[model samples]
Target chain A: MDLTPLFLPQSVAVIGVSSSNDRHPANVIFSKNLLRYPVRTHAVNPKGGVLHGEKVFPSVSAVPEEVDLAVVAVRAEYVGSVLQECIAAGVKSAIVISGGFSESGRDDLQTGLVDLAARHDFPFVGPNCLGLYSPGIIDTFFLPAERMVQPPKGGVAIVSQSGGILVDLLVKFADEGVGISCAISIGNKAIIRERQLLEFLASDSRTGVIVFYVEGFARDEGRDFVRMARDCGKPVIVMKAGKTNEGGRAVSSHTASLAGDYQVFRSVLKQHGVIEARNEYELASYCEALSCYSDKSIEGRIGIVTGSGGHGAMAVDACISKGLSVPGFSESIRQQLQDGFSASIRSIAAVGNPVDLTGSALENDFVSAVETLSITPEIDCILLLLLPYLPGISSDLGASISQVYRRSGKPLVAYVPHVEKYRMLIEGFELNRVPVASSIESAVNMTSVLRRCRPC
Target chain B: MLKKEIQNILDSSREVGWVLEPNAKSLLHMAGLPVPRYGWAENIEEAASMAAEIGYPIAAKVVSPAVVHKTEVQGVSLGIDSQEKLQEFYRKMSILPEFAGILVEEMVEGEELIVGATIDYQFGPTVLFGIGGTAVEVYKDVALRMAPLAPEDMSSMLQELKGGKLLAGYRGKEPIKFSALTEVLLSFSDLLMDIAPFIESIDLNPLLCSAQGCVVADARIILADQ
Candidate 1:
């Protein structure tokens, strides 16, 4: 059995809560977020009581509740005794967040924790780590994220070894209005590692796409994780770092990790069906698309609709970069676009595959071109390029895209520059059960990644 | 064949090794190899007179168990045309603290090749044969085959190297009898196959290729006798 209770805890006990400067950083912040979660929380501290208006029990056993997960924030040297109390209290899941374990090359304390964990069959999160936050279960991250973090619900689940990278990715997604099912920061993996997590996530219904940021991988461990994801038939994208020798050595020093032969890692990833991402943004956008539209089939071609000629060219380049074809319209469809577009729109567009809907194009003009493209049995998908700064846009772009989205089984994904204007458009697509995106890269990545993961 | 002879040496006296280079080559010559004619000497007078008796324009080199590659330490002198040069050569070679004795020999001329046999810890005894003049190791154009290899295998191993092109009359050169070189490689292979357990390394470097036949010019055999 997996120690998922460690991450998906219904009742939690925060072991070292305090308002003072010295008590760990995660404790002070998580103490407030825990109040929002529907959980029986036991705040353990002898000196402080009623933190976040919750009673502070001296120890976990005295809390008089079934503690599924225990977050220990005591001193590094005193963590072993805290774990001993957790084991006695029948705490099946424990997240050890304080640093200075085996990662510091201190042998004895690390060994003690490992032995203590094994006898009781408890899984650990980290000795130096930012904890898990599963948005699917409303398990928000403990890092004062409430003020800025708007959790978007979709298919993507991310597991990062670096906590800093995890937070940074979340912020990036928030900036783009892209959401995730779960974001996990598994630092200094004292007990749980990528392999076990991959196997467990294979059975999870909430997670459709799994993205990871890796600096290094141990010989057999990372290979096993890839194979598990492949067998589960989920798209796994990795932003594998350390492509150079010096970068590889740095990866080793950072994680105390053995960076296996890079070619071997590449070979295994290919054989087991994992996609290597180009960067963090693409990695997130790729998984976001996969998780959102895991069932859709992007046959072979795309129709581009843009406000300017430059955006049209950029969209064509994006399609070509993704190895997707921009199949042209039939002669009748081209004439229909010529008839639908005004004189100003007709002068700029050569009426090719990337039909540049020139400036002054209105909501009716957008609707007419899409109606023409979608009705054609020739086109497979539509890449709707919307510039919020453009004129004659119906404040109802969200409703218009949703109508086109449902009328044709072909997917409609958009790229918007104005975040405020497109927020409701994104929500409108979600309401109509049509997949939408915020960035052009995200749109391209999502299409390619989803098409690859759920192939023809 | 040479295989049966080496088998007799290993079976009879496998413990106490014939340790030094000269002693080991004497054992090889006794085992039916055409080793170079040489006389072992102690002092300068004996070495020079031995070189004179063997004839002028001879070679004088130290024979030592401690010294492995003579050229590495400048331990050998070739073409001693006079008694003075021979004595001087003896003075430099014999006085080395590591040197065991001096070998005064008549220098023979023709083509030269190296033949070796090594027992691999994993694949067992292996034989190697290739070009050998002055820079054999530096120009590592060689071929190897598993030991106890057949005569045909030895011929094929020779054909495996680009250096073996010389044995076939390279660039307007007189071919050093192909049959003779093949015989030397096969015999070396037989030697390794027969000795098996007790033998660790064998080197017959500069196996001179003459108009008549191929003869062993110098040899060093290391025995793991313990």
Candidate 2:
């Protein structure tokens, strides 16, 4: 199925909009899209009243405009009729934002929605979800626009099982300057799930990396998903919940007992070349790095350049523990790096695997070290642990290093503390396409995950 | 392709619901996997002759549907080096409930390892390789992959094990032929895939490995409940 209509819908009808309550989820979605997004928005309610100065059609078919998608936010019992009206009206797709389905112990109702959608050959996002947010195209999330921070538009597409987690990630992505192309909340997944969305996003021209926040998979669903990811031609990162053996099934063999759900899920993900994020931080770190550098070729070899020797040591330790190599610089490269540095700090600088240009080193020294490392054939990537608090380092160092990064065409990542004062420095690197992490550990994680996902 | 011999063994053991050691070993042997030379005996006279023919220091295991773990029931007697000892094992074990017969097999020793397969709920037919013995549960050092094993998966699974280095000649021990071990795992993978629909799980525990190659020292096949 072509998912273009679901994601890039030009016209949307918001069903269940209430004229009496502007705070209703359906009203919130209608006003958010009509006021901000580019998609043509229509409101639908049984009362046939005015909402936000627009005529509210009594049903979907009453809308005179051609509707590509319908955002259903009615009560659980009314969702079936609302969806039927959408199918009869020939709407291309729907996103059911209502909650009372399988998650509420109403499997029969959820199954009814599935059968209704299947019989009509229709596709929808959820029976209980916040729905999708395709930047500039449409926004179906019921959360009011002013309350949530919108992430900048870019390559990473997130498909999550929990809407709360999706909203949290959006806030995080916005705060971290991690650009996102879309965010989909697939609660209950009564009609569409991760596997289908993964296939869609893999072929999406706008999506460079795909991330999934999975709680569990149905029978054989995970296998089919990972197998598709093996050749999806895009980087797929998954952060799974329910890793513990709290609900393990009774089995009779060592293999079965040892094959805990998480263990098996993790193993399958690794075997199929999917990056498994162990925690939320890794998820964001990986998505941030991969969103920026998935197109670059990155071997596991890293060359660390830091203003503080302690940061360099920590970075080297983190790199080695993650199975990434911090190969020692060749004598000639070290000599060249030293030649580029001023005598004030060159004599005391440590020019080994992780070159430490001490606190006294100026911005020129850091940029020169990064430049030298970027051209070195032995170094597959560079990790710059920038300490903005240092005396000689200027804020323009981010811009200076980014210039070298662009000229050398080598992948570079920066570790800048996420302080308000250093926003300019972080933005300078990020705007020039170099990913910046808030912590040294996240910086190393970004480089390592980028290397692991280089093939896709 | 599944061997007809394995099919017949599975077919005959249908009523029992699980394949016993001797028949499991026969299934492995027929599938071209290396198993210790063995024979089944229903009587003391037959057990004595089979032990003599297979040579001394043989292991005798009880073949009964009701007894899954023979060692726990004191139904396993190792180092039965004499005809009298074999008769004594039969006399003692025959009194146990559901005592069907004795499986007489040549005793072999080497580094212990395990290869197993189970039909996972989601992935279906996953294979495991790791350190094996009575401590298989205690150590819990294993690596798993979806079956119909990939060429690279075999070595990667071995590499993932904590005791993988032990297989490459630990200390003064000679390393077992890796190609031989790979062939056995691949054949076992094929057999598991072929029988996955009918079986719940299978185990080739304590597969003794040395310079001579690998052997299935013990085997267990659990058929799916009807």
Candidate 3:
């Protein structure tokens, strides 16, 4: 199915908009799209009325212009009729935002929606979901615009099973400056599931890295999903829940018992080229890094440059624990890095793999070390542990180091404490397409995840 | 084709939910996996002669649908080096309910490992590799991949196991030829694909590996419920 209209619809109709209650999910979606997004938004209600100064049509058929997408947020009993109206009105696709489907023991009602959609050859997002959010194109989430923080628009695309998780990630991504191409919450997944979304986003022009927050997959769904990911030609990162035995069903053999849901899910992901994130933090770190450096591959050789020796040691430990090598600089590379250092801190600097240009080092010293390591043939990637509080380090340090990153195409990530004072430094690296993490471990995780996505 | 042959075996063994070890071993052998030289014996005389032909220091297991776990039922006796021991094993095993016969096979020992396939709910046929023995349950060191596997998939499965180093040799021991092990794994994968429709799960535990080659020490196949 072509998912273009579902994601990049030019016109949208919001069904079940309420004139009395402004807090209604349908109204929230209607007003958000009408006021903020560029998509022409039309409101629909059984009783014709006015909402936010726009005429609310009695039904989708009464809409003046052609409706490309329908956002249905009516009661479970009324969802089928609304979907039928949408299909009859020639609406290309729909996003069913109402709950009380299979999740609330209304499998029959959910099945009815599926049959109606299939009979009409129509496509829809969910019967129990928060719907999708495509920046500048559409936002079907019920959360009011003011209540949520929309991340800057860029390459990452997130498809999640839980609306709650999707909203939380949007806020986190915004806070971390991780730009997103789109965010989809596929609640219940009665119609569109992760596999279909994966197929769509794998070819999406705006999407460079795809992340999935999956709870579980139905029979044979996971197998198909991984096979698609194996040839998707982009980094597909997944964070699966239910990793323990609590979710396992009764089984007969030692293999069955041992092959718990999470174990098999994890193994197949590795067998394919999909990257598995252990936690929410890893998910965000991986998405942020992969989206920024999608074209770069980490071959497990990491070179670290830190202002503090302690941070370097921690990065080394993190690298080594993840099976990444932090090889010592060769004699010539070591001499070259030392030669580029400023005279004031040249003697005090530790010109090794995790080249520590001590507290007295200037901004130029850090840039020089990064530049030297970035050009070094032995280093696959560079980890910059920037301590902005150093006496000689200036605010332009991020921009200065980004220049070196831009000149040499080697992938670089930085660890900057997420303090307001260092926002510019972080932005400087990020704006230049280099990822910055709040913690040293997160930066190391980014490099490790990149290593997993090595091109075959 | 092996699929038709495997289906015939499943069709004939409809009464036994778990295919007997002798049949499971034959299935593996027919699929080109290495198994110790063996024969089925209906009595003490046959057991003794088969042990002599296959070489002594052999293992004898009860071939009965009533005993799914032979060791747990005390229906297995290893190191039956002489005629007295073979006769003793036959007498002990023949007393068990629904006793079919005795499966006498040459004993082989090396680093014990397990290779199994189970019908996963989501991934369907999934192959499992791990450290095996009686302690398989206790240690629980295992890795899995959806079958039929690619060559790279087989190698990665080995790398994922915590005890995978044992197969590569450890502490001055000669490493088992990875090609030999991978061949067994590949054949097992092909067999799994052929019989997946007829079976729910299969276990080849204690698949002994040495510098020489890998061999299936024990086999079990559980047919899917009708």
TM-score of 3: 0.97
Q: Write the per-residue lDDT of candidate 3 for residues A162-236, one digit (tens) a residue.
A: 999999998889888889999999898877888889999998999999999999998889989999998989999
lDDT score for residue B106 of model 3:
88
Best by DockQ: 3
lDDT by residue (tens digit), candidate 2, B1-226: 7667778899888898889888898888888899988889999999999998999999998888888877788888888889999999988888888888999999988888998888877888888888988678789898888878888998888889989898898898889778888998999898888989889888788888888889998888988887
Tell how far residue A431 is off in model 3, in angstroms.
Answer: 1.0
- lDDT, model 1: 0.69
> In candidate 2, residue A317 scores what lDDT?
92
B-chain TM-score for every candidate: 0.85, 0.96, 0.96
Q: Give the poorly placed runs of model 1, Cα more than 4 Å off.
A: A19-23, A46-53, A136-142, A145-148, A247-260, A336-349, A375-377, A419-427, A430-442, B1-226
Ten-residue region with minimum lDDT total, candidate 2 chain B:
B1-10
Docking outcome class, model 3: medium
| DockQ agreement of candidate 1 with the native complex | 0.02
lDDT of 1 by residue, A394-445 (tens): 5577678768768776766767664665667566665665556666766766
| Per-candidate interface DockQ score | 0.02, 0.68, 0.78
- Model 2 chain A lDDT-worst window of ten: A247-256
Fraction of true inter-chain Cα contacts (below 8 Å) kept per model?
0.00, 0.49, 0.75
Which model, 1 or 2, shows the larger TM-score? 2
